[model samples]
Target: MSTAPLSAPRPSPPMPRRTGRLFALTGAVVGVIYGYDTGSISGALVFLSKDFDLTETEKGLVNSILVFGSILGALIGGKLADALGRRAAMLIVACSYAVFVALSAVAPNVEVLDAVRFLLGVAIGISIVAAPLYVAESTPARIRGASVAAYQVATVVGIVLTYFVNWGLSGGGHWRWMLGLSAIPAALVVIPLLRLPDTPRWYVLKGRTERAVEVMAATDPDADPHAEVAAVRAALTEESGGSVRSLLRKPYARAAVFVVGLGFFCQITGINAVTYYSPQIFEEMGFTGNGQNFLLPSFVELASLVAAVLAILIIDRLGRRVVLLTGIGTMAVMLAVLTVVFSAGKLHGATTWVGFAAILLFTAAFNFGFGSLIWVYASEAFPAQLRSTGASVMLTADLVANLVIAQFFPSLMAKAGAAATFAGLGVLALCALAFAAVTAPETKGRQLEEIQDYWSNGGRWPTAPEPGPVGAGPLGGSAASPASPS
Candidate 1:
């Protein structure tokens, strides 16, 4: 009895490497939204304060309340990502961003603006968790650093783009447009994502093996789909659960210490302080004439983008620990020099130039190492099951530190003066350096599954795969359609 003649074998559809590219590109829109949100305010505040007649404390609250909102979004979004899915969480974030940004634009008073900005922060926080996690999970291990670094590159682009936007809007009382324009891009990012699927890792965890295999085929065509499925299944089986509580155990707990420290220090070391207040800082350094205050930081963020590109080139080669240490060391030294320069209280001539140059150097150094690696490392430091939760926990520390720095920076500059304020930040850089030296492991060239084993094995490097076909790495060529799995 020919059982209806076993259906002729189905052919495996062509697996386009574009899947990986699309993954990074789509994830980066969130970064653009994030960058624009944070950077636009730096310029908008110039007008916002004037119109509202805001006090320094009021200014600080407006800048910092977004961070407070992000803290809540991160914690809740983490659970949502794990419980529902990454794709869903990101969709919610995008819609929220568009709606809240429009609301923020229309607010008539400082109190109303503050409330809307805080709600907007919730969207930023959720995107922070969703974007990096999606990039890390969706790409192959080999190109993971570059893929995540793309997010940083997009951030710098968004920041730089806002500089121009802020400039165009500067001549008019158009700060509202600067704040509201983000809705356009937020809506744009959503359109492409509608066609995208939840990550294969999430599918595997949910026991949707068929769907996982389909996604894996598209993303990493050379890898055996069944092997990929089995690996995720096995990894999940070895774990007790995928909750935040699970992350507080054994090897994961140790990794958490490192990640949390990285997150907290990443902010407290004054990166965001410099970014959010570059114009004010430049003005204080006597670069205010001729619109140089805004122009110079626009140039600096351009340099930051270049540094991010350099990081993508070198991170996998030099390794995370080496790059991070180098970055922290350079930033600390630059901050120290600025401390000395500001202490001299020189407002013009060579001294002013020296302080200005130091800010440029610090901005470049940060994006080169710590800025690029922080998210990449945080995303990789946890196991598959705990990645989203771990990233959330890490980012929560980051935002808390961000809130403290943003809220207190003006007051600190007032109370301690610029020299002492930067001096405190410079010292935090030393602390970050020490933490990396002690706890940060080299994560280059390892699979996500392999990284968990590496951490469990007392921080040993995982066995490296032998070099394979050209373009076989994560960012490689399209695959020829093969016979479907029998």
Candidate 2:
């Protein structure tokens, strides 16, 4: 055997490029739909509370229960997506949530609202798991970051659009329409799901080698599909990838803890509270008066969108750890300031302007690192076999944390008052800062193959600086076939 191999075997073929862009676009649309739903409830809750005679606490829970379902859904959704094709599972969830979104409009009371929200949360959970993973797996290494950022851009766009929709529909009775409208986008996702091809990586895992090539061609029509398929097959063979069990193994468990823990911190830093209740938080900032004051708070969404764009641009350049640290650090300071501003019980004319400005700044900081990187980091932090499950576990925590904050925000605001409520958020932000400083690794510009060994090495930045793609070799370098084309 050794005597036969003095020279290398024939190189694999090349791949088409169209397949990558198509998959990336699909991811962007899914991101938009998910993001839209995340904020849609913010404006709809007011009307919903009235229609169902919900108490303040009930209304908050109604808003958050869906996120709780989303948590569990994220955990389970990943396993499902991995085991049963990301496309298939995402499509199923898409249909389920679209129906439920419409059904939510007819909910008889808070009880039904909770159920609908929970189901919808499940849908969003699935979207979270499938969308990011799809972009990461499907895109060419050259454009993976940009592709994933497109998803982020879509999410922010969805949020901004939701705010505008909320503003347009604002009143005592527009909540039903708000909740129901999510289905429209869900329906739209169906068209793409039907047309967009499945992931080639997933196909290879299923042993559909020929089909994987076909998908590779569709996704990257300009490149050599067979070569791409062969490279993917080689990568998969070497990866030793599979279901969720590998995630719990000792080696992976270490990385899983860091990634998931950071994810948890990302969720509980009071960002969701601000997103869900900016209008209310602003009111407490002593900017009372229903008309323009209420509308003014909505502008924070614009800040959030801007922050995401900035983060996308800088993430690869600045490195993940520093960005996370900076975001967490800034958020901590702002939350503390907000706490003082609220606790003091005095609102100068400038206080209102400063208050809204600070809130927007806070939104910016949160989005800059924690918001955008959470999805990207989560998707990349794990080995391929356990990628979905591990991400799901983390996102479940995220969504549940979202629920904890959202479910009790109004009550917390009522009981502790604004100062304490915001102070709590400040404390959480501090913890995130500490977490980032201690545990988070710089992942900017690293390739997936180089990423796996990162866990084995305890996430130390390599000193040798052997750069091929971005990070180390096992998961980093791109494989091109020489047999077919240049």
Candidate 3:
């Protein structure tokens, strides 16, 4: 492939400026499907239980089966993305999402539905890992946090939108429609996936530097394509093969611990408990009316979404450590307050309002920090070579935590009541906060390759490392620009 002359004065035509935003927006469809799948199920569960006469164990099974499938998806999907490329893996996920979800909608019995949900689970799992990885690879470091967090924002959009869908379908066993409607967005996302280019990073990895440069120029015209291409080549040169064994060693192993911890805590923060079964939670809080149950949780999720938007705006400025610590601290406090309020016994009037406010605060705080940060952190943590596989390691941890919680939460509620369940989670939240304080690094404006050095140092970088070949330019590393031809 011909290279751009290093000192050439030739003017290159500008690519469309809107490319980055459009790509990020398209990638967020994965988040929408994730939100819809998770958020919609809670509402549907209420009606589904009635239809199937499901026992508590069966109910938990139904809720957790998707997560179980997700675990498998993340494990395999990460490798799939690395091997087949991000765009292709996403295509597979999108098609699977449309097919399985549609199958789920028409399932004739609980056994059929559960089996289908598990299949659908695989698609959702892959979508979550591949989408953020794509967005991270495609955007510049300056806005990487916000761009990837766009997935989380899209998740909130899905959750908030699905709440309304649930409300509309809440009548007399229309749960099938709620479960199936998700395919529309899945189909919509597939349209863009069909047209989108594979990430430049992936292109570079495949030694298709010419194509990589083309993608970069289109995405960010201001970038010096030759410098960016050289940086990517250098980074790839330093990297080893992305074998699973490699990821399990020394620096990568230690990094995996941090990623896994973050993923595990992200789920155990009680966010899912509220999101997945908010109606039931409201009922426990003494709001037995259907409107209060559904409407309040929807509003809570809206608050959560708004908080995520705020995170996106300030994440680049505040840095990951500060924002993450502050958010976790706030969440821990709020969860404690929730435990206290709920423990004060089920009540009416002002107390109920207090409970609602507490729930809102907890949800908001979680979305502010962990919701967006988890994806940002996970997507950026690994070296480029193992990016997708490393993401799977963490994502698998997340889904494992999710599966266990989903399967046992209802029984935990039945056994110990909501207050105790929340109190325990609050304790876990404090532990998460402690973990962040001890190990989290500042990765606000660093290139993806540069960020890996943090883990290389065992998560203690008292000062920033020197700029390396991966992003050694005025604009910093292989940025959004494409390479110019010689």
Clashing pairs in 1: none
Q: How does model 2 fare in lDDT? A: 0.73
TM-score between candidate 3 and the true structure: 0.91
**Candidate 3 structure lDDT:** 0.82
lDDT-better candidate, 2 vs 3: 3
Q: Comparing candidate 2 with candidate 3, which one achieves the higher TM-score?
A: 3
The residue-by-residue lDDT of candidate 3 on 1-486, one tens digit each, is 554446654443444664677679888878888888888888888998888899877888888899988989998988888789999998898888888989988888899999998988888888888999989988988899999988999999889988888877676558889889988778788887877788888988887787788788777677876777767777777667887787888667877778889999989877888888888888878887656687677888899889999999999998887778888999999888888887888668898888889889898888889998999988898777888888888888888888778877888888898789889999999999999887677788887877665555555442433546633532233222322210
lDDT by candidate, in order shown? 0.83, 0.73, 0.82
Residue 332 shift from truth in candidate 2, angstroms = 1.5
Off-target runs (Cα >4 Å) in candidate 1 are 1-17, 462-486
Model 3, residue 73: C-alpha shift (Å): 0.5
lDDT per residue as tens, model 2, 1-486: 222345654534444447577677777777877777888777777666666677776876777787877877887888788788888886887787689889887787778778888888888888888888888877665556556766877887887877777777885447777777868778787887776656877877777777777776766566687987776666566555555566667557777777778878887888888768866676666666653434664577777788788777776676677667777788888888787777667667877677777788888888777887787777777656667777787787777677778877788888888788888888888888887787776666665545665565545543444435542344443232212100
Question: How many clashing residue pairs are found in candidate 3?
Answer: 5
Q: Rank order by lDDT, top first?
A: 1, 3, 2
Q: lDDT score, residue 184, model 1? A: 86
RMSD of 3: 6.2
Native-referenced Cα lDDT, model 1: 0.83
Candidate 1 minimal-lDDT segment of 10 residues: 477-486
